[model samples]
Target: MCKLYQFVPIFCISLSVVCAKECSIVVLEDSNEFIKIADCSRRGLSQVPQTLPRDITVLNLRRNNFQIISNFSFKRYRFLQKVTLSENKLQKIEDQAFFGLSRLNNLNMSDNTLDLLTVYTPEMFLPIENLTVLDIQRNIQEHNNDVYRYPDVAFGVFKKIVYLALDLAPIPELGQGFQNLQNLKSLIFDRCFLKFLRGDTFENFTSNLEELRLTRCLHYFLHVDDNALSPFPKIAKINFEGSCMHLKQALSMLSSYSGKTLDIINLRGLNCPRFNSDEYPFVLTVTKDMMRYLKTVCVETLDLSDNGIVDFEENSLLSFDRPECIKHLYFKGNRFAFTKGRQIDELNTFFNKSIALKTFDYSFIPVRYWLEENAVHHNEQNYHSSNNIIYLPRSLEKLILSNLLCNDIRRHFMNRRGSNLTYLDVSYSYSNNVVIFESNASFTTETLVLDGHFHAALYQIEIVNFIHVKTLLWRSANLLYAMYPLDNMFYKRFITWFRKLKKLEHLDMSSNLLWILPDDLFLELDRLSELRLSKNLFQSVPTQIIFCSTIKTLDLRNNLLSTVDYATRVWADLMSTNHGFSLYIEGNAFECKCDNLNFIKWIQETKVDLDSRSYKCTLLNGTVITVLEAYETMHDLFSNCRNSIWLTVSSTLLGTSIIGVVLLIIYSKRWNIAVFFYRKFRKMVEKNMVKVTLMMFSFHMAGTAYLGLHNV
Candidate 1:
């Protein structure tokens, strides 16, 4: 009991010592670069590591146990340019803690226990004159339940600050003392509690701020007074995503920034006010009056994703007086009402005037209700309208319709010329609806993405429909069968379909559960340079790829390959010799064995470009090693294999040589050998005959003596 009591203290002391050692800082060395970095993250360190180099330019001390930043704590790091002390237990930063960091341009002190009273002192940030980016978000924790307002002069000294993130609670107003921050270009106030934006809220910014983010600040609505953003004439970008504001408030916000060309306005999830919610469910249509102020504000990109917007008032897009000014629009995660065949006319007329609009994303729009409504309407009308075509803006180049219901996209785009659209994405569309492409209704988009499962009725997506497609992405389509291997008919169809894309340059069929491809799959794709078959069930390098001379990059990552065979490597080497070829085989199951010695050697010597990292090969005894380590010590590991191969070749040559020499002796002395055998045979025959004759003579002499005796 006494020994156990004594050992407790020793063990505790040893544990503390080990923990101290684990908290040691690490300095990254860059031999070819001048920037030195010190990383002390997640170490439970109570204080900064003083052993770091004085010339370190970047320091990361996030997620530590630092309670306070003492005065002049970083005075030694004079060359420091960026420092992050986020996610720490910091309660106070003593004045002059960053006294000598004159070159510090960025500082992050977010996610700490800092209070406004202790952090807002005049001397707290007086030394960082060159600092351009400062993030102290989520640090103004409540003290005694009293509302704390930011002081006017708190950040007045940071005249050169370009970006500031103040994602704290209960910030009632941006104080008037920010007039000195004339160079402040970006400001973020995400998750703040105070809602009202008065006209003078940003009047002190002196018109230099270019970007403002008030994302998710007001959970319900954010009221903006008229001319609230009139002070910053150069403000180009604003994000109010998830700020459930009324349409009038949004118009007021845009009105304040009139005559200024805003680059992006992201109002995703606006949750516009619904009129007569009990009578008309899901009727949050964007009306022309709600967008009247947008006519004065020339915004280039507007993202209204997930806003519960069902339909747009006719000529709503024209509310932007100069419709050509708006270029990109995102309407993802909305449920638009497409009831009848002519319901697409609303969309056609809505964007008919936006001639310069280039990109449009309408992904994730559910159409289950629309399908039911259309069915009911069709039953009442007793007729079907096959001419339900959608007319997109002629100037639009890129369109994304992913995760929506399939509505015969080729038929919708039948009127669009091949050269008008550049990219089209119909991936993840509903599988129940069948899409058929008429011979004249093919899309000539440069890029086409067709991922996810299509119904069995979609046996032929028919690559002829995408004859001009240069890049095709067909990932996760389940090209192979589930319970059985790929059928010959399906394989032949794939071959025939892909051969039609004569202009295909890049093809990605990743995550397709594919084991092999037909030999003629890419036969006619003479321009194909890159092929991606990643995340598949390929056990070996596809034999069909060796014949593709135009292929320069082949990505076969995350496959079931145990080892690449010699023939594939030879073909890859040949391709590398003729032209540069990069074969990415990362994330494959590789095995290291004597039989794979040549493959290991090829990895080190092949001219084909292979991934340097993520090539872990398992050995015979279940030991795992990286490709680099295997390359470095492969000679020692497989020396016996090399010796065995040499032994086999030498033994084969020796045996063959001895057999040839014996055959040559028999062939050169054929006549002599035959004559010697003949002479020996004759001698033996003569000896036998002489013995027989002697026996006959003895018998005759006996018979003659007996006859003479009888006569006497």
Candidate 2:
């Protein structure tokens, strides 16, 4: 007692104490009566603490080497609320480790050595109903449910927990998994559930569950038979990020008609195939009456991704309601090449029917494929556009159509009309002079994302008399727009028309051909806050932009950037006179030689947003090498010889030497250095290639074995 009192120094003084290579301890003597155990990091203690003080509240034993925890090891921690034991060596928890924690709430056990929970009893966590968050991740141990046993009663307590994570390993079994959990909200099961889940496993989720996740689960071949998910009727949301590539039998097995579920269904890793044809069929199938019955289905967000199905029936679109009432549709990462006129007509039908649809995303498809296929859906025989998708839905708000080819640009040639919707993301697209805008239409749109492509001349955009748009995103506008007299009068008309948009808040023109913003562009709508102008052709930032007091989050990645002194000159003008702003200069190829070196050094030393990320440079001599991969010094980014003497001398010397050497031992045959090197490299590469050149070897072997068996 005397030693404890002496060590309980109630002062803010530095106290350093090193522990064993596998063990460390920190005693925080706060102004209060309890001892604050803090930072027992990087030690190798394999067991749970046996001598924890009763009054300790904040215990941080992160980055250690702990393994097992017997009964009553932490039963005395009744008031322990915050405990972080991340990156440890602990595996199994034997029931009573969390016995009587009344006020315990946040437990972070990330980066541990546990794979699965084998033995847990009801007495383990009886007093823990007030927990709000729990995290246990990164287990290096093996997980096999045949050997591990479930807890006696898992859901008996901790019902009020909000955020829960078993990220490292999977939950082995559902035996008494969620028995009394009445108010569990956010649930996460990452890389767990190695085997198929036994139905009736979640029989305890009788109450309304908010968010449910199954990320990286091994046994994604789970089905809902009889009483499988009976208790979880009020589950509003579910995210099934299965580790498999495809779901063959899953749709038939998991599709429930209970009518109690609602909100969202995120079929993530939808690209991963799960079942084989022999094991589970019904993939890419238009069978029986399931397609017909899908008409009555309703989901907020439908994610059908990574399914490499190139051809689908046109009637599939008709399955959805028209003037469409769905919220967000994600079709990215799928090989959805265009179909024929019949499919195009069906899409028109679906769009006309479902009017409430808000967002539609079809980004990341190949430019050629999208253009060749969907952009130009010909009438089976002809390869030209007909009455293919002539109208855009009125309910459309946010649309992402990216990576389109120039042919598709021609097809969408501003000749078509669309809704005056809110948001549009048309980046990674090829825009040409094909699209024609209707006169006097007064294009009324908000938040247009024109990043990642060459925005052709503003025919419709520039000629429009009164265009009302808000939040213009012109990032990655590398190419030239079509000819437009958008100098003084054009800016006046455009700004006047744009100033009518009272809701304008953000203006992102990053990575564009913006040498300078049209003179007084910022004075029009002062409500703008988020401005992004990174990765552009700006030799000098206009000093007038500093007056934009409302602007924050400025991006300036990758451009013909000059000195850091010039950047500071801009920031200094802003900070010294006007106000505060964040600056980004990440990928700018600045001349970092003698004079420019000072700018680079100053940028590093200042509070500017260099972001600590590496910048890649394309040098002349080291042009073949990557800046990130090469261990070269930073001076190479700006160092270049002023005189052509080095180039001339080196070239002349090499030429003379080559000529003399050619006279001495030049090969009369066609065998040169290039030929020799190419042959050697090709031979070595071919030699070192994988031996299994014959793909589908298993199928070939199976066929051979079958033939042999038949002959016998």
Candidate 3:
């Protein structure tokens, strides 16, 4: 048996050696059996590895310093599907570099120094007949003016390429190379220095192309030929973002997509000099002619944001033949003067055109100067026009009108057409009465924001109308002092209306100059989970906060609180019930003395989440430290103060006791002491007489003795 097993081992050793030699390179198995991946990227390799696995389907060689891709480099890996050689110093790729890789679908050579397609020979892409995605973006040097030429036969070889990214790779002209790519669906030419788009520039790709991006092209002007994209029946997206397109070119581009079902059209930051008028010198106005082109395209979402649009010409939107096709319109960060009556009327008319619009965002549209000068005129005109009502589209569900300077916003809500509106943001607006729902009107809106200074009347109206709102933000509104001293009447009025907001869950009243909160101010908000009251004048945690059993986030930052007793109690109560709540009590002026020693200790040992790193304390010597750091060094100081206080009290008590004992002894022995002193005094006088006689005799003797001595 031993002899037979030893003879079988010889045959197995020879087979292992043969298999190792055939598949010597590193390989990573993919989930799919047909695809094997290998990564030799950034290995400082000068040439392709020689013995790569034959079944490798994807190879990544990025960030290497290889100079050339030699012929038959991937001949063994005939099943390769993708190869990425980006960010390399590759200068040349041989004509048959990808020889026998007929199954390859993707080839990326971006960010390299290669000029593989400059000559446009058929052999450039001869090996990869099935390539679908070819990315050669950013391959040439900055000073190189040699554009990539596409010969007619080269396109036939790369006909299967559906996605092509040629960013920063200039092309001399739209030759028959593009016409031969019948299967191409996406074409990107970002930063390609394309100064013009002729009428038939994309005529060959009109039937199969779906996405076209020309971002940041044509620094001076983009001259789009008429009906340039008219044949693109299936095109879904066209992006010209950051392109300085002339007004005529823009109109012609839009005209090409007339009556086509486009999903998105992003013309952000489009520079149109023709629409700039003297009245609005720097900004472009959406004129009737522009609207005429926009209405022709059947688009779902149109992003015209950051386009320097100041205002819409009167009845400009009315010119739209089919405005219902657009669902969302974004005009944020534009400078619009919608303060005059005519301007407001024009805006209202514009909304009336887009009856199917679901969202309209006009936030940050500055109207301060216009409102300051024409507010009264707008009011008078509104009073006479259609009963002071402004209409909105019936299909609008979300509206944002933030940072507008209109003083009276009641007209915006009067006779509002949409009952399905769910989100409304009017923050940073100077409005008097913003919400004016009819008495019989009911709304389905869940979020409402009025986070700006407003009139008292508007606050009152908002409190009543937004009773069903779940998220309400009225921050920095000076609501705390709208009625001086926050009198009982004001509290009653506020509570009366506030208690009706039973659905409120998120409330932000931060940056309001509130010194104290009423005990029952938030009792009725049973569903509140987040309360933001930061940047106020509060010196202590409001005891009424304990009633918020459902609160998970309490923000009391940047206040004047000096102690944490109430805060500790609040944290304890919340934690004892297992109701997790994050406390933001940083930026408070906490004292760092023995008086607050317990508070400092509590903060250090608190189990609840707190922003304690910024919880600073002011010491007696004016030294500020974080609460935890102060706690580490303050225990001895507190103990020393306690000992000193005890020592002073004990000394005072001992002195008092000694004085009381002396007084008691004197009072109890008062008669006895007086009789004893009287007898003693008599004895003392008798003794004094006797002593005085003896002393006189002694003095006489001494004088006689002295006289005798002197006579002698």
Relative to the true structure, candidate 1 reaches a TM of 0.71
RMSD of each: 11.2, 26.8, 15.2
Structural similarity to truth (TM-score) of each candidate: 0.71, 0.63, 0.60
Candidate 3, residue 45: lDDT: 53
What are the lDDT scores of the predictions, listed in order?
Answer: 0.73, 0.55, 0.71
Name the candidate that leads on TM-score: 1
Q: How would the candidate models be sorted by TM-score, starting from the highest?
A: 1, 2, 3
Candidate closer to the true structure by TM-score (higher is better), 1 or 3? 1
The digit string of per-residue lDDT tens for model 1 on 395-456 reads: 77888878886442222533344326778777887723323344455465799888885333
**Which run of 10 residues does model 1 get worst, by summed lDDT?**
1-10
Q: lDDT (0-100) at residue 229 of candidate 3? A: 73
Question: lDDT tens string, model 2, 341-370?
Answer: 665566666666667777777666653434
Mark the 10 consecutive residues where model 2 has the least summed lDDT: 1-10
**Clash count list over all predictions:** 0, 34, 0
Tell me the deviation in Å of residue 229 in model 2: 3.8
Q: Pick by lDDT: which candidate is best?
A: 1
What is the Å distance of residue 247 in model 3 from its true position?
Answer: 6.7
| Whole-model lDDT, model 2 | 0.55
